[model samples]
Target chain A: MRLKTRPSHREKQLSEDKNFLHRFGYAQELLRDMGGFSNFAISFSIISILTGAVSLYGHGLTYGGTGMMGFGWPLVALFCMMVAASMAELASAIPTAGALYHWASLLGNKRWGWYTAWINLIGQIGIVAGIDYSVAFFADGLLSPVLGYRMTETTTLIIFALVLVSHGVLNHVGIRIVARLNDFSAWYHLGVVLILVVSLAGFGKGELQPVDSLFRLGETFSDKPYWLAFLIGLLQAQWTFTGYDASAHTIEETIHPRVRAPWGIFSSVAFSFVAGMIMLAFVTLSIQDVHAAVSADNPFIFVISQALGSTFGQVVLWMIVLAMWFCGLSSVTSFSRMMYAFARDRGMPRSDWFARINKHYRTPVAAIWLAVILSFILALTDYFIKLVNPDTTYTTLAFLTGVSVVGLYVSYGIPIWLRLIAESKGRFTPRHLGPWNLGKWGRTVAILALLWIAIISVVMVIPPNQNAGIALIMMMIVLLIMDLTYYRHHFPGPEAALQVSPEELARREAEFHD
Target chain B: MTMLGVLLILAACAVALAIGIIANRNVRAFNEETHESFLGDRKERDAFEDPSVS
Candidate 1:
């Protein structure tokens, strides 16, 4: 009794290549405007690890997994970096503003392409909001603690406005300045953080705790279980890695970016992971009490103060303040670029206006300003929330951002999975990846990274508390409404629909092939 | 150390060595092929659009 073969739905979809042709207007010249590999790395690192300072909000996550888990924060950093490296290779191959969505379209059916773009759009916008809100949170952190002044809604508004305007002006000046600034930020950020970590480790007068003590640290917090700690740390790690693809988003503006942009994404992520791990290890070894330190107080600052006294601590504090500013400002650069790209594709509202470039500066000044305003608005809302409920403020925003990051990982994974499937069928092979090649291991690592991202995404959106749950639902509703009403109506469907006909494709193929 | 940590440290070292080796290979290849440390070629640039075949 031979069983009849069942027709597979996905196979049917794959056979429909008529719907798979893509729009390819982005010229190689776009890459020339982008600074270089180092600038790309700096942009990515600045946006990703800087805001991860909020991990103090969820330190319980790292508390119980292993004696090694005490220092697992750094390992988490390493994992995030590995994920970035995998993503970088793919981005280098397909240097498009649409990024992951376009990648999905290239490797899979057309129907999935629109949905992929939607998911990525959601993630990118959420990141912008998250970064802007982080700016407010960190700014509030400095003013509130040191000045002993309560941060008002107005203050947050003022901070947001100033930052937005500054971001707008910087983007207006074009790529060279942005790249230079990013380079400066990379060194400044690392140098300052290094000083802070070393000072805390070597000079802190507080009773030093062994790294082993952090293993059961959550026991002292609220008697949480081991799984809870592991869960929290997973979320924290995801947060730290939220923007490791800043280079991918701005490939349109980089020089020789086809080769260098991927390096930027992979290398920056690699640097962040290694550097972050070392920093976390030192901090964990030097921490007084995980619970007390990560409290409403400036945890790292608290540690530094205990170790180095007010004078030296003050200097470190100033450095941290500058770092946060640079981090926030650099994020503006990335977010604005993402916004401009989305707008350019007519995947967003007011594409004509938002996608417009300043002729002299050759930057998307309009999109930059739009992002700045929206970010400012989000920051103002965050400030109001904080004023209403100080205890839940930071955690709430962090959790929201975490949920949004899920959208990013999903965006990254779908394209990769499509590529993996294609490769299995001998439809894809990367011959020019050179020594950066991971071979079969690339697929394995990518799949692992995808699984990790999927698990954490689910964990993040689950809501840690009843209040958080309610807020999450409301935020989703608001975001959906905004997208449907404003963006959906305005978006020119499937930017890839602007296809060069078979004739043009043939001409270009023949002309370029030899 | 945990498996992850030990593995990561080893991986990092391996990656560093691989990069060094690749850099050396690139330099040598360029020198042998074209008598220069810089190896970028117009043909290579032409191949940029479709790297799958290179």
Candidate 2:
């Protein structure tokens, strides 16, 4: 007879983790190997400070000038940490995949989950679309001499498809590979940023901007009020601060999730908040001529080339492109995970198709493609729009950013709001509170977070992004219609998973093992 | 001054987060205790409802 042996501490911990998840009515499907750092890395990689900061640097300069660049960023960062802290508490209480959806379903209602899941997914898809398209745009502009042609709409679509396809394939393989890359990406962002900041200070031959100009209290462009433009400039940092929820959304695959995942959420934002400020400050200070840099077609590139030679700048740009690629890769991973979790509860239109996990790969093959294809379609919106209305300034680029930033903030707000309401009513008892809780500070943070979301959502949709504003209103009407006609009858919501008995739950999990 | 204010707020948040980490380190044990309490209460209720307990 084989001797009975005690389970190792790691094995015991895994069992406890699985049981904790089972209470929330989920099977341990995704491999649970991600530690605190790995959990933090996924969110950090998705945040991709280099990608957002560099991509939107010109927008900041044109709209808000030095004051906005200096003041607006950290202000946005401060509010974003409040948002992260609020989210972290919820992430701790119920550390599930597609965390926002689960939190809403339990705290509020199924309809809330449905809307939150859809909006969050839309935001993520928009992010993936925007990130990859920026890569193609930069590659065409910066490397055109070597590549031999500028990117037309047709060529741009081709490049966009290629980039999305690569991310899809990488994600389809498995989370292990994706997590490893995300870990490397986190370090890469910090290291490259350190290099870039130092390079700008040490290698620049150009005259620096005035020291006092950093706090100059006015806008460079006055087409709009200084305050309005400054708020609009907040998009540059607001966009970067997003996707830190990737940590929450991947908690099922993380160990000791209640504590680790919350840490992941806050740490990712806090790090990006600091690192991004340093990077932008260096770039702003290195500007030889404000007019020349701001008026140039691509201010970020112009600033780099002016500070260092074009050859050296090109090297830096290539590194940034690679960072964007990693950003897209990590994004698709989070997108598919959320899609899979939502579909698992029959929340999506074709739930079963998207919810399937490849037995061998243990990854959602169909959902990965769903994210790729949806984002690709959104990416092409600009191409068709420009072809139809050549004079229009309303491109889908702003639409994508608006949807991504505003839609995500809205999705994030629903759960926070619901939790606040539950607490105010005294319905949310201590058992409902998570281990890594904000306690008395929770309500205060949630209120601030919602107020910030409301402010930014309005700012994101006005003026140049009016089309996005219209689109969002249309989306709400469509969702309400769908809920009444289709989902009301057909969809079971999260109860499909949540109502399962203990015996049934074990049987379903066993099927995976076999 | 704005920079200083922002940095100050960020630092306060960071310190609070660090405190949360140390405070919540024993979630696994807390979860176990909660589960045991729940099961123990259920068993007591079951025993109380037994017909022979009269």
Candidate 3:
């Protein structure tokens, strides 16, 4: 008789993972160089606390005062953790590059999945544009003294384009390099944020705000009700918590994804929550004059420069600028992977080209460039809007960011809600639970996540002014029309286009069940 | 800080700790279950494919 030697543990795990990919009708295309830490790094890097917490601190302070930074952050973080937990369950279940799109389709239906994919794609593009532009804005301020000239909007736009292109080039190089940069990015964000917080706590020259002042209700800088202003202030936390889906989107490139990807999603949010709150507290306490800080453009920058002096503050700001650039780069990586996966399932026009992997670099070059180009277009559109009507500039950009955040959260909520329904109805039950499973807590977390998304979706659209609300409604109408006319007929969804033969799927399923 | 601020900070820590513990437990349990199930499945498949292996 022939002897059969058993495969080693690592070999067995790789084989099963590859078989799992085969069941989805995809070969192992992307290089799987990412371990658990690298998997976590991508999401952590994309959700760079330096980018959103510092950039948008003024917005929160304007509407909700220091109370938002002190009290509102943890509250928002708790809710976000719930959402992240729900997403982790789904990530473990599907563990594909399509991520949310694949989960929605498998749990719900093709139409739902198509809408989810489009919304997520739009959100990814918007996020890339927003993050890169924000970086450009900061870089402009940082370089103005060195350049001896105030940077204009056109100059910033040029810088934004260059940043976007550079991110695209780096992503095209390979996943290995991207993973290394993201690993570096995770530590850099934590180290720099810690340094800044410590500096503000110890050496800040301004008189610190009293502890009670941190939680006391203050002015909203608006005529709206206090509660409404507080909700608006929550945007700082909401926006920062986004793009953690980066981990899920990179599942195909991650090792032992069924376990690692879920943990990646959960731990990124958990760490960000703790670290973000500490940073927020320190920055809020360092603000000497609330009115003066709020009145100044880029209040966080103003506070930093004032507290630390221009030279030291600029040096610190350079660190943030680098982190933001890394944030934008990681965003592109996530965006391109989503685009490639969606296209691979024939969800977009010219699906074959966008889905093509570069043999030389083992990266999706076409998808990366497409995302880069679309983001550039979005940024250019924002620039033109400002040039044409400066009065509506803030409102327009706010509307875009609003749409981005709403779209992504809505997409996230849909699958979680559907999963909840599926589980309750006994329609779907995961045979192999991922390491991040909430178990009995899953239902409670999913329900709360859905509710939170529903509330935030409304808050996002109605912000800044009524024009934003109107624009949001118009955009929804456009999406619906496009869905009915084109996508409904052409899109095959993830499973329809990517699933293997029934017998093979059954065998794989049976093996897992065993 | 106000009582509310202190409470908020304490609550944040509490929530973080609770979730961290839950996550750690889940990871450990999941690893054990997955490893055991995978080995069982492989043995069953091997036995079925080759009678002599049994």
Candidate 4:
């Protein structure tokens, strides 16, 4: 008899990943160009420190003073790490695109998965909109001096659309290019943030704040109690820590995903937490005058410009804008993957088109365009609202950001809670426990994640001002209506539709190789 | 520096150090275990991949 040769490590890994995909009735449609580092890079790029920390610094300072930066950031980061750890465990167990939906389906039922998928889809789109709009704000700032005028709402909208389209085009190219960009983005964020911090510390012209000021709980922009203001200030950290799910959502394109995906999710949050805290300390300490900084439209820009000369500050701002653009681009990649996966399992409308991978590029081109177009529409709506009612006091960014956080965190919590219940009852045995299993610590972390998400969900919906709760209610109403109508009759959930019997999966795998 | 500022700095250091150590240890353990397990499974995989097998 002829001797059979053993497959190499790389081949075994690829074969195992392919078999996992076959179990879900997929045929390795997307190119698997991402390694562990690239997987981590995607999540880190999405959680770009330059994007959230810079955009929302003034908001945090206004609500909770410098103490928010000093204390609240680490506190929120700790809770977010807990949430990420729990989700990482689940991601390792499933290792699929649209990870949250698949986890919910396997852990709970199809109905649960359907709702989670929709919520995750909405959240991803919102992230694209929010990140791009922030990019437009910075881009306009960068161009205004050269253009000899500040950007009007219309001009800003144009910039936003252009950025969105550029991101969509880049995503359409292929996963390889996207992974490369994300890898570059990760380094850019780390290097730029460190450079900015060091520059501010070394060459800052302004007198540093008294050390107590960093920890002093001072006045708020809102009339609420000090505790509530502090709680509200936590939004900056919470938002910054999001989109780590991008790692899980792109698990299908990752090598050694069972081990790598979980580490990607965990490490992204861990690294961001440390880097963000250090950056916050440098920026907050370098603030010359708290009142002047907070009063300016962009406090971060104000602080940098005042301390480090306008030219250097502008250069830093340009770097941040580039980082945010990369952030939005990576978000599109992640959002399109989730949309394609959902569509492939017949969970979306026009499934046939959205599920189609470009033969040449090997990408979900249609889904990428759809995500960007929706983001563009949302950005346009925000611009139009500002133009028509400049004095009406509507907070478009706040509402959109709230919807995004609440939806994403709730979707994250559902599967975690279900997994906790199943584990406690001794019914949740994973078919293949990935390398990063939490073992005994899993249950405790899951409980804490659920609690943290619950608190943030309530905080997200209860707006600080009048007319702020409308978005949350609207999202609920839409979900309710869907549950009552279309989804009730037609949705069989991801498990029923995607899972294949062992024999059928074997047959399909053989055919796929052929 | 104020006590709070010192405290904040110390806390940041502690968090960074603790998480760094944990992540490093876990990653090392994973690599070692995976290497051993893959070596142990080579024969079984060879048998499984054989076309003449079941």
Candidate 5:
């Protein structure tokens, strides 16, 4: 055998580049290239409908609305959602896995980027766990009767396992396939919900109640404050519309990302708002007794079953359950990609493992599975807790998810402010969005959205009861404990990823040209 | 019997899994070929970077 030669300096550089490309898969030139406006609209619409529909029926319209009575339930839905829409637009334009956190780092002083990404990452995983566990709840409801089994913790685990595996396999299939499937899921969800809601409304036997009486914000049966209910409703709306930033996570994979990604993000939010409003209206109209029905287990299912008998109703319920699984799976897929992107940058523990792509699937299989396993474990916590107290087992995992949503918005707001600050100092210039510039409107909208999200975050953590207060506190503790273990070691990084100095990059380009 | 239903479910899952395994293997082969063809020192650039190759 011949002796190996030492690598030349250029060879060493080439080798490092090759290794990086191999690790991350081929450079998806998505940052500079993305599909047309239509593709953005379609993809965003798909993801939004998938994420939105499950929450609308399961929680948003009825229970969530009931909680936000003080803010004029319907009007609150309208105003808060408009802010969310503007925020989504901002997130879309700067789509990256670091997402809002990365944007914050890029726009702000370099010192803040690492901590911001950490917060966003923590929030994202919490949302993944929440969405996945909800699938368990919905699946358990559908399968219990079909399998001739009761709603035990074991059955819930099985439900979570099947979904986790299906999602893992599907995510392994790659982004193009996932986007196509999401397209089907979006239209399928709309079709199913439209058919079910219309059919139930037309054939339903329940006498219609007056909207004015039903929405009377101050009408209270107990000592609970009316404002408390409204605050809860706002939280629900936020949850229902929360994950539309999914488009931002896929920006690296999209073609012509800056423009298209923003469109996707905004369209998903706008479409979901419309579709969700309709679904909420239909469910509100379909209820037999609004007050009593909202409190029932699977209230939407109850409304369907009451209107269409057990046989036909169960079919519709099962369809919704399946759609919910698709939603959860899609959400998890986005969540894993975000984690993979961050970990690839050595921003997370097990960066090598987390960042690894499946050569076969052209997907982040390792990250996808990691997300699933974590979610599965979280789902088990519900079963264990509920075993001790039957009533408590069905606690709001989504509320914890709401905390993450607030975290996401804060991540978003931080970046927007930093970008503005950088612009003021002449260190950053606003990127062109072609002729569709928000112009002066961008500044006004951005400020309003940031303030609104901050307020919502505080409202979300307010305990529903003394017990809920304690629960919220403990949840924060758990999140903090987890963060310390994984992220605290590398509390920050060497500070290059955060450097978005326009002048420096410009100078480098000039030198290279010379 | 519903046991029949269970068996049918298992059979469907088997069929799906088989297809997935075959598909996964084929994709792996394709990626390996692509990596060799595009990034391989022997191969010249074909036009430019693929739009989908992020």
Candidate 6:
């Protein structure tokens, strides 16, 4: 029969996206046009192999020689892949902003989510500080001579502020610009890696270390036992592996988030592992003297300069610095979104302001500035510490690096652990929860991931970074006090968002309509 | 010393290989249908049916 057909919506997916978010009792405030690649792009940009691998290249060389770059990297990447896969399953099941916090809440209780949110926030703050500060210090180390300017502590702090502000403004405007930049960033990072690998290989024909040199392990700087020092150096890979959770944080802005977000989380880590290996292989092989490279102001740049001469090294160093800039910009986007999502449910002080999305931009403007401010303050530690004792400042850098890796891993571990316990008691099956099921391997993978996290959490906080260990314990105690006295009486948790009716959710979403 | 070094390298490689086997099984679960119990909380479902948002 020639009956009138209902006008088919060109985008059936938009309706489904809104429906999914409504099921969680929140309106889709952030705009969502992010395709699968864009979803992958955010996480990859944050991982930024060039950013972390190069910045911490000297750390790895000092603690475990070159073996950590060769062996320790894959070892940590293996565990990180397991972590990413496990997280992908949760992200697929409950695709939302603040996905880690919500996963813990639903899997266990509000307490788990509360702890996860605060710890994740701390990690984000540390990462934002670390990434921006690294760019400043790395730039200072590589370009001070070339640019004919000094990057003293005060000067570098100023540079850090300028970098943080640009990222804040870019993120405050909208996700569209940030997403485009991240996509470009992903390509920029890989292209630079390719160029460096090829250039170093061509230039370093006779200068490169033997291939077997990659497996050579020792503790040249620290007097710790070889095994212990190697364990500490593994922190380098863990630090590089941080922030892939950016994919989960941006779920609301991603199209088909349940499927796409999980892919984003896992694929970013997978790609980074391979690409980072190749880049590190060439860079480390090009090192003529491990001791000199390890002791240099900027070891990664030193190796390149040694191989390809000062001029070529300076050009390559500039390229790497640009990648770090992109890396920091993406970190700001990820960090601010986590803050906004946590605030959405009164998880922070003055939640009303932080949670508000700008009408014109559909971006979290207040949260973006909050991230920038917090990181800027934290970045000042370098200036103050260097002013006091420049010799011990790298220890402070190690603390920041430790805080980020340990904090994020703790947050990631909680949900996976809680989910495992729930499934063991037959609360739910992996098949029923999400599209990304581990099936029978759920227990084994979860256990392995939990074990990996436990080991690194301890190893990362040892010796020189004991300040991080103290900070973490104190942070936990303070959060517990705050929760027991304040949040317990007031905060109803993310589950409160889901207490809305279908009609009410529709009305709330309508508020975002143009 | 050389033998121990080879063993350390091999042990790390072995760990990666074992993890890789599990990782393969966990690859790219897109294009699969997810179960509809995401907002599976019984209380939350009642909230959806009820007239108010708490």
Q: What TM-score would every model get versus the actual structure?
A: 0.76, 0.91, 0.90, 0.89, 0.73, 0.91
lDDT per residue as tens, model 2, A1-514 = 1112345766777787889888766788777778788899999988888877777777777778877667877778778888888899888887889699878766666667788898898788878887887777666667666778764667767877899999999999888898899999999999889889889888877766765566555756638778888877777878878888899888888877878888889889888877888788888888877888888867888989888788998999888888888888988888898999999988878898998888777788999999999999887776777788888865445667777888789999888887776666564655666676666667777898899988998998888778777767877788888877887666666655656778877776676662
Q: State the lDDT of candidate 6 residue by residue for A282-382, as single tens digits.
A: 88888888888888877777888888888877888889888989988988988888889989989889999999989889899999999999888766664
lDDT of 4 by residue, A13-67 (tens): 7777887666555667677768888999999998888887777788788888888
| TM-scores of chain B alone in all candidate structures, in the order given | 0.51, 0.46, 0.53, 0.53, 0.51, 0.46
Candidate order by decreasing TM-score:
2, 6, 3, 4, 1, 5
DockQ-superior candidate, 2 or 5: 2
Q: In model 4, where do residues sit more than 4 Å from their true spots?
A: A1-8, A430-432, A465-468, A497-514, B1-54
Model 6 C-alpha lDDT versus the unseen true structure: 0.80
Each candidate's DockQ: 0.04, 0.07, 0.16, 0.08, 0.01, 0.17
Model 4 agreement with the true structure over B25-48: per-residue lDDT tens digits: 554555423321110111111212
> Candidate 1 chain A: minimum summed lDDT over ten consecutive residues — where?
A14-23
lDDT of 1: 0.56
lDDT of 3 at A405: 77
Residue A52, model 4, lDDT: 78
Error of 3 at A120 (Å): 0.8
Clashing pairs in 3: A211-B1, A212-B1
- Interface RMSD after interface superposition, each candidate: 12.7, 10.8, 11.8, 12.4, 20.4, 8.0
Give per-residue CA lDDT, model 6, range B1-54, as digits (tens).
435545644564455455445444444442345456554343432222333211
Number of backbone collisions per candidate: 8, 0, 2, 0, 13, 0
Candidate 4, chain A: TM-score? 0.94
